[model samples]
Target: MDHNISKHISGNFNQELENVRNHVLAMGGLVEQQLNSALDAVNDSNAELAKKVEHGDYKVNAMEVSIDEECTRIIAKRQPAASDLRLVVAIAKTIADLERIGDEARRIAKVALESTAKDQQGLLGNIDNMGRHVSQMLHDVLDAFARMDAEAAFRVHKEDAKVDREYEALTRQIMTYMMEDPRSIPKVMDLVWSVRSLERIGDRCQNIAEYVIYFVKGKDIRHTSQDDIERDIIGK
Candidate 1:
């Protein structure tokens, strides 16, 4: 949490804001766990675990609603200004992304449940590797948001490109496998969809990182070039 917002403030306004931020972080933690479980289901081919991930999504959804309501209440009652308003707005947007990420995790879990591919060790390994990267990106962005660190957020933004490259590689490999073995098409297609979900998760993480930058600097860097973002963040 950023102490700058709470400093010198009296009464419960700061406390309420802090509570909202904490709830968002808690929601983030749950989503991260859901993502990890979904990946485990893929690597182990455990349908039961995938089912668990699906069921766990309800919790994430509930938290998102709860946090959004709290933010709205704060806005109605307190009408914060400047950085305080930025904090609330950023958190509101972040939870929305988190909810979508949860949805993608559930989709990946469904893929795991449906896949019946044999001799998919190589494909599963690629998915596991991609999962790790996206998972780390999620963790890093959440931390950046909590600390209000724009520089850390920029680092996460850069990592998304690497994830995109890995996703492209996985797609190519899956396509080659499908071409060589028509019988494996069904299973390969499921893996392809699962990787697609993971790639989308990476994209969402990048979105959250951009929100962190916005929260910290009050700049909307969406659709801006990387060079421009670099210059803006570094004050060049």
Candidate 2:
């Protein structure tokens, strides 16, 4: 193709990219809702709310598959190079992160459904707080992606430590309770799973933030710590 024709095709190719991004955003919205619903279900011991989350997982999975295929098709057809390739690669990775986040949310809902709680107050409250933070982290990471704002992405990365700390505290507390009273063992087991799912969700949020940094600067932030990312490069 001539330069003019190639340019035209590239412009059209952007539409495909935009479509995938939009679909991913839509999936993100649903995942966000699923997290909230899962938290509520756990707090209230509502099997119905958990069921809603279970059903929503199917849609999230389907969206991820559709977006991945579209990105693949666009690249195969356009043969994008340089920054164009970067953007496409970023989209593909972002979709995977979103899908995993959806899976984490599903896991949380499943725990809620299976749990039999003697004390809903502590187990549900701690994990719910963690879930809210993770959800907000994801929201900001997505915003950074849409805006191409590396600084905002860096800020979201710092938030992961808070979630991790909460997860640790919850784990210790739940384990102590189980040890103190063996009868609480059954319920505490489910709480452990609940806390674990929330922690994984936070981890995935961090992954998304790393991707945002990658998308913005073409930098690999995965192996590096938050302090390293901020002080070594993103800060400067």
Candidate 3:
């Protein structure tokens, strides 16, 4: 009877942990959707869509608060240690990243709403491509978190470099456009801000990937070199 009671308690604790994790993932999904919608608004020059994205940020913020509270409750009630402790810490940190990503998305939407540039000028296409890359990075990192796959997280970390390069290239192009035509400066400046936001989103995704590694290996690999991170995860 004692063993049965102990087992039941353990099962309940595990369920609580799972619930918190699911909430974090759900929050990530909402942030991803918000980002995609913001990007679409930029591409289509749709103020209505931008407004919708802005409004959706509230839901993301609420999810962050909910998941955070649940994590705190589990930690206090269950007194989890070892791997379970790591899991909760990771979920908390990842949710923070997700919230910041939502902020970046909201900023992008604001830029879209303010932008008056209707001409494609090929800049929108470039921005769209960059947005798609970062979006995929977010999706992949979230999948890694769901599966707790350190290898997958590492792969996503590597992809961030490509996003950085794309951001730099886009900035250079926008600068050139502004110089060639001063009348385009205001619109190009808005595009620059949007690009910067997308770049920051990539950085946030990489941070989540680091959290995945931390959760899996009990190592904080935030500032570690790429080669070292690869060695650490692969060696394990």
- Candidate 1, residues 118-169, lDDT tens digits: the string is 6788888988999999999999998888887788899999899999999999
Which parts of model 3 have CA positions greater than 4 angstroms off?
A: 1-12
- Candidate 2: worst-modelled 10 consecutive residues by lDDT: 1-10
Candidate 2 is scored at a TM of 0.90
Q: Tell me model 2's lDDT, rounded to 2 decimals.
A: 0.78
Pairwise TM-score winner, candidates 1 and 3: 1
Ranking by lDDT: 1, 3, 2
**TM-score for each predicted model, relative to the true structure:** 0.94, 0.90, 0.92
Looking at model 1, the pairs that clash are none
Give the whole-model CA lDDT for all candidates, comma-separated: 0.88, 0.78, 0.86
Question: Looking at candidate 3, what is the lDDT of residue 216?
Answer: 76
lDDT of 1: 0.88
Q: Write the per-residue lDDT of candidate 2 for residues 1-236, one digit (tens) a residue.
A: 22322332356576676666677778788888888888788777789989999999999889888888988898888888765677678778888888888887777887767756556576667777777888788888877766657788788888888988998898888888888889878767877887888788778877777776776667888888767888876866
Top candidate (TM-score): 1
Clashing pairs in 3: none
Give the residue spans of candidate 2 off by over 4 A.
Answer: 1-12
